[model samples]
Target chain A: MTRVHDMGGRYGDGPVRPEPQGVPAFAADWHPRALALTVAAGGLGKWNIDMARHAREALAPRDYNRFAYYEKWIAALADMLVSEGLVSRAELTDGQGAAPGPEGPAAGPVTVQKVRQMIANGAPADRAASAPARFVPGDRVRTRRPAANLFVDGGHTRLPQYAAGAEGRVLRVHGSHVLPDRSAHKLGEGAEPLYAVAFAASALWARPEHPRDEVVLDLWQSYLEAV
Target chain B: MPHDHSDHDHPHALLPPDPALRVKALETILTRKGLIEPAALDEIIDTYQNRIGPQNGAQVVARAWTDPAFRADLLRDATAVVADMGFYGRQGEHIVAVENTPEQHNMVVCTLCSCYPWPLLGIPPGWYKSDAYRARAVREPRRVLSEFGVELPEDTAVRVWDSTAEVRYLVVPMRPAGTEAMDAAALARLVTRDSMIGTGLVTAP
Candidate 1:
């Protein structure tokens, strides 16, 4: 159940190409518009950030790979609008209004002034820590191994496939924060203590290309166990 | 094995290839539904395109390079220190400033999604979000750094920070030599976006 979006440590994707000098923030004129649309629609308070990510991740593998970056945003935003009952598929396809949209508890349409305020006051995910952190810096820990089913229910997770079950040392303790695994599934924030775990290069890959190199991941308390 | 094309029942195949047209249609429909405001969309685009960007990150790096106290504060409590500079916003709610010394080099990547510090660095660059980078940066950082024309010393340890949680990281690159006399503005100009991301290094002008 490892989705294509969880692409860490897999091979043969291709070479990295840096954008040309002084390239604009966006390549195409429509790119910024696509980003703006997604932001504005998201401001309606219909879904949280985790749900937005889940919508994009839920795309079919073929479509996920085939669509360009902003194209994926546009596609996912379209599907969310329809599925959330904000708009109808017919309205989108025909470019016409079929009926008056449902008046749910949506924060009214975002105005220009609100856009500046919202962008400055971006959504903060850090929640109040209910209990003391389980691990501390310098403590040895291991990431949780996925069960045999491997999340067939398609719950959203921040744990990449490469880091699963790897032994590492805690580098720092970042207080409680929302766990995306539950947030994406309409579950509660499930706030938990997060840690910065450092795994040596040799521990992750079969061959030690750079023995001293290391990879650090911000893992939740639930994802780690004392080793 | 090649992808089987026989099963062409993908629902999204009906989507128009021209994204501009699709976006326009979607916007029109959403406006009619009173779900989104066009002016708000304009403001969102303008803010990221014109106001927020790498210059903000460069300013922070410049201040850190010139002021010892500021640098220490950045490494110890980046969230508060950075917000004091008016660089607080989404994707940067919890910030960690990792400094690069002669012994250790730090790099940032989000293997899960494009989780970048938008308020400080604006939108992520195209290559930063590419599948190749997401897949290889964690496994083969040395090779990835070399591809970006950055080669570290043999003994320098490379630490790749993968953004798995909400906590975002900003790499405080080592200041280049022969720039002690330069002012903060000049020093800021020397700090590129890639340098702060740890893919490239600052060079003296």
Candidate 2:
């Protein structure tokens, strides 16, 4: 019997590969399958021509409300994936499960690249270590206008268009890099940690008067600055 | 095809009107009549809700509840803290948090969209997100509460929070009647979800 572990964890196409015969090597392996699953779970199954038409119609002016409605459909796609077994419940719930144990039935080594790919591929994205947070609770900060995509809907996606670059304070540090729950269903790899970030109001607005007028946002680490 | 009210929720009913057509309608009526331009209306909507909405109320309530010396702070700096929380996104800059006291209770509504205080309170509840709650929250708030099985004393003042623009509102319900003896988590439980929206108050059960 030839040992496959000698290849340094890379999925090589050699005859000696033993056990777990059909696993794909890169994160993009199951893209189509995953997308199909997402679409199905997002309530797009059976293709409601009328509903689609309405949603398309609603998007003519690109208002946030239309986007919110679209999110429901996207969420339905994620739900379909979970039901169909293309995505596992463990994967969905373990966006922060880096505790060095059995990851799953197909447990294998995880890499930072894999983590990034999971996020890009629509899994939930937690906090990233590349950009560590500087401010803590009691520290004041301002929201900066960073360039990013703002989805107006409320499904498995990133920050709402209405909340991009909004500012606040650090209410609590939910450990290290965790997934941002908002996009976790679409971007997570089933077991990783995403960071949690909080922002305040006075930091974002000008001359206003309430003290507790503070708002707390659970942001990914990638969405922060020192100020 | 007879118009059947019973079969109204046939999935097709949920479909919304087209945006371009709605925009055209507004343009023809408002812009042509010199009432407003498309860009101007967009800017106005954005500014009203984002720069001056719910964050305004939260700041006022938070300040007053936290500091005895800041009643003036509550009134004057509503949106300032909203800025602090970076609540200045697309439609949520102008914000406010309302306080519900022993003498008064506060509730919020958005005659349009489910506009809410996303920065502070997270997402709005399913009930608040429903049209029934929004439509009745302002007009017959007391009656709606009765439907939810919540009855208030006749003498208690009721304040309804109507959110226009992106100015959302949160009810800082007076700390529960006996909540002074409780901890934060304990207080949190007593802070029923409905109480935060001003539809109900926390009771020590």
Candidate 3:
């Protein structure tokens, strides 16, 4: 949905801050734990990564930008854990909630060795190549909104606001990918061919001196149409 | 859009934002329930911070700089080329390396979220996750690049790669001039994480 998180082309936030040479990944002690818990819980295979993303997108638009990256992660992790019955609200508040007690599916008790292997193997989303890609590189195409309403709907979407209508050429056709839109809502992946659509910066904005500059957006088959 | 409007959640803004107490609370609950092991959690964090990071990608870029065959392989099939070099994992299983020449400059941004190639670049830098960068990088890339002190010539066509899928991008920045004599090991030292991210250039030594 068109929330603060989808802040492409929009402005007024601030200048890009220079990241110092060597900053620690986790600022606070909890930051690492927050990231670790989210990844570990997400490893359970209960909800797709897309679904977990909505947990943050579902937050108030104001809160979305205010929370730090890992903070949003922790929020999403907590929301998923509680709503999925992995932990109870009382338990979250009390910090001593009883386990689900073998009633429903548990997400994880991920071992160190398993995480190492998973990190090595990686969670690749590439599915088998499907029907011949409709649009090959050099094919002119336009991105379609498709969704009825972006913000109120509160689901997953890769279509950024900046490049939705702006025309472009397909730079390359990435093989079939798990359609994040459907996967985010618990719908089956129904993998489809994805393409990297390139739109000229001149077309995207009213700026000058960028006739040759372009932005390449990775789009799902459904998000595009032959132009 | 029914949300958790329960009394239990009322202390949200006053409490949920607190990284300290909330994490302690969560650790207490998840550990008591036998979900997460502290050691395993730290291991994942350590891997990204130390073992897997820009140094790995720097090595790849360095090798490509010195070896024409490896460079060709990287451009053709970065996934296999990078994997063959032993850099494969989360946020980086499938990657496409876009080459930047004097005529073309490539930049990377997730736009949707901070979807960086963690296994290659370690954790994403803070600016990468900033609201200003995500919003403007795709819109005014030249301006964004300038903000990062990357002044490109007007003739250079800037290509901003919006990482919308699981397939992450690593910009094979043009090797700086006056480094022809440098070997792969020394060249690796020159590749900063920002250079690979396309936000900064690999300045001459």
Candidate 4:
């Protein structure tokens, strides 16, 4: 159940590295193509962002440390293309295999205008929340550990390990959105009320150094229980 | 993108690991299938390369520093307010601006994954996506901040926002002393990506 991607509060990897002040967005020629392939495939409107994330995290845990950031994107893109029947494994491996097209107009050679429109109008994650809002702002809540049936392999989650079983106060109620835990699994994504729960530094770690500090996590209603 | 393919790497490492060749192969395959338009790819690339980035976030922070009503508006509805200024979408759809004051300072991190406001901040810096950062940012933020040369008063409460859902946070850092004469544009220049991320501070002029 412990996916290597969920790296909250784990120690001993290495020191936090310094970032270059101005690394170009596309550091290499492949970088732009990697971004394009993923973005273009996404334009098909077949999968949500959660599924894309799962595909990335789905990489072998051993490979997590080895692959570069965009490398992960390429790997995931290849997997998604093949598994979704958009491309075949042979095409991905040797660039020779062909894939079947869906009915109607194929969303290819995405137009420049379409790109601008998509960027201008951000993908609002506000789904149609069905249930009434459960907890309001200022309510005490704790993050529930991943429920048993949440995932088959127990791979991906927005819920970090540090906040599990930890208590915090609801700072604000972010209107209901698709709960990613379910969405990643292609399961039912019943929109639910989400809250910004704030926990003291002492609550998350043992014998905290910065007691004055706190962490606020945006937790969905299902991941929380009243304290 | 530097490829670090060690001779001691795993079996999968032996595949077409050259980034350029690999991407080219993928692109060729997609093009053959009519799945990707190079024009669309150019727009996407140009957007991240030239159009939007952290400067957009700095402008927002600068406006908040100089304009009171806009600050209130930003705190109330940052997504719409930020969108009003023409910076909205993607990783920045729902923004919640947490102000840094003498009492409390705010920092943003996504512990589970790297969920940054790409529309505002463009792509996150390399460090922000590191496994070390994703793990340590929450456990020892002060140390991490210090490592980045950011020092806060011991009394000031540090609030780290682990952006877990669609909502993204922008840290409205306190303006440095003796900057009252400066205009929004000048103040905006003083703002750094790290300051907004709360790992570093805006230095006093």
Best-performing candidate as measured by DockQ: 3
Judging by lDDT against the true structure, name the best candidate. 1
Q: For each model in turn, which proportion of the native inter-chain contacts is also found?
A: 0.62, 0.00, 0.62, 0.61
Each model's interface RMSD (Å)? 5.1, 26.2, 3.6, 6.5
What C-alpha lDDT, on a 0 to 100 scale, does residue A12 get in candidate 4?
Answer: 88
Report the lDDT tens digits of candidate 2 across residue range A1-45.
111101111222222111111111222322222222222222213
The C-alpha TM-scores of every prediction are 0.93, 0.35, 0.93, 0.92
Where model 2 places Cα greater than 4 Å from the true spot, the runs are: A1-227, B1-66, B70-72, B82-91, B183-189
> Which lDDT tens digits does candidate 3 get at residues A1-227?
36567877886876888676433355677777777777777666667777777667766666676778877877777777776677777776676756556653265677787788778887788899765689889998888754322322555688887777768899888899988877776667768898988888887788744788888888888888899
- Index of the highest-TM-score prediction: 1
Tell me the whole-model lDDT of each prediction, alpha carbons only. Answer: 0.82, 0.38, 0.78, 0.77
Model 2 TM-score is 0.35
Cα shift from native, residue B93, model 2 (Å): 1.8
As for model 2, its CA RMSD to the true structure in angstroms is 23.5
Q: For candidate 4, what is the lDDT?
A: 0.77
- For model 1, how does the per-residue alpha-carbon lDDT over B88-169 read when each residue is reduced to its tens digit? 9867888999999999999999987788888778888999999999888999988889899999999999999999888889
lDDT of 4 by residue, A136-227 (tens): 88888888864322544554567777778888898888888987777766677778888889999899998576768898888888888899
The candidates, ranked best first by DockQ, are 3, 1, 4, 2
